[model samples]
Target: MRAMVVAAVVIALAAASPVLAETVACHLTYGGETQVIESAPLASPYAGTPTAIGSFFLFRIIFVREPADLARINLYVYAHAEFGEAPTPVQHASYPYPVSNHGRYGFTGLQRVYEPKHESELQYWCEMRGA
Candidate 1:
């Protein structure tokens, strides 16, 4: 039936959508002079305690507006920080950025975000406003 076909199409769209949640808790940490981001807004940012989630699929940083000011940022997991830097964003808008899974240690939903060059990693990102 036409109705059945429509239902299938809807289901397909949902599957294609990126899975996510609201308010992703990004743990920012830095102490050494190079720790705090050097730019406008605020100075000297540090890490916060990890947040707990019962269960979910995956978590990523959905920037309301990507942080183009960030010189470097580190994703915390397994007591290790992966260093990353943003290279002058050509444009500014909301975009989804993926957070790699670190086995048992990972957060779900959109938590953190920073500017990326030419948005080469966009495919891995999800929708910021909603999952």
Candidate 2:
């Protein structure tokens, strides 16, 4: 009976603990190809790096989990040249914590962005799992 009580207490504590592991996966589609980028929430927004997509775009997703009120996710898309020219910011999207998923699921739905110079289209959607 004592062992059973201890086991119950342990289970209760575990259930009350906060979820420290979360994954935010983004599906990126461009130029007839698709790519997925998965990331866990970071303590700092500056910890993320951009990934090159094809010859014209650099994409980045940053998830920051701080205080409950301050948690957020930011997506950045940049227009980049294969040459030595600098990358120019094209699109930026910010989603606050507990994103607007009415009842469907964790998916945030499809979002379309465009590059200013070439007017190229980039499509992406993101799903968040865990807390």
Candidate 3:
């Protein structure tokens, strides 16, 4: 019984480790269709540019602050839409954060994107700061 409990604890810690390692997070949503994101893009330490969209349905990202971080959470979004001419983004939001940055902080995020018109060739890039 003790061994099973310990194993469960180990798995929980392993799952939470990734959130502690990151400083930025994001969320993206589309109006329709389900989609899949290939990998997590690193916004710091290295430059990331995901600009390749082909036969895409929908892709989005969402982020939240880990309880341990104890800092303001920020989110970023990068997406491309498909269309006869070009997918026009309908809206953009600039939400506010409650407190100031705690210096060393991290975030976790996911994205949802959609490409109905083109259904192909939908890609983009974005970042966030001072959540």
The residue-by-residue lDDT of candidate 3 on 39-86, one tens digit each, is 342334223433223333323333333333432323333334435554
User: What total of clashing residue pairs does each candidate reach?
Assistant: 4, 0, 19
- Score each candidate by Cα lDDT: 0.30, 0.82, 0.36
lDDT tens digits, residue span 1-131, model 2: 99999999999999999866677888899998999988888888889899988777889988887877878988898988647888898888888976655333245578787877777888888888665
The TM-score that candidate 3 achieves is 0.23
Model 1 stretches with alpha carbons more than 4 Å out: 21-24, 27-29, 32-131
Candidate 1 residue lDDT tens string, 19-59 = 75433333332221111111121222343332211111111
> What are the models' TM-scores?
0.23, 0.76, 0.23
Show where candidate 2 strays beyond 4 Å: 5-20, 100-107
Local lDDT at 80 for model 3 = 48
The RMSD (Cα, Å) of candidate 1 is 16.2
Q: What is the lDDT of residue 42 in candidate 3?
A: 34
Q: Highest lDDT: which candidate? A: 2
Worst-scoring 10-residue span by lDDT in model 1: 32-41
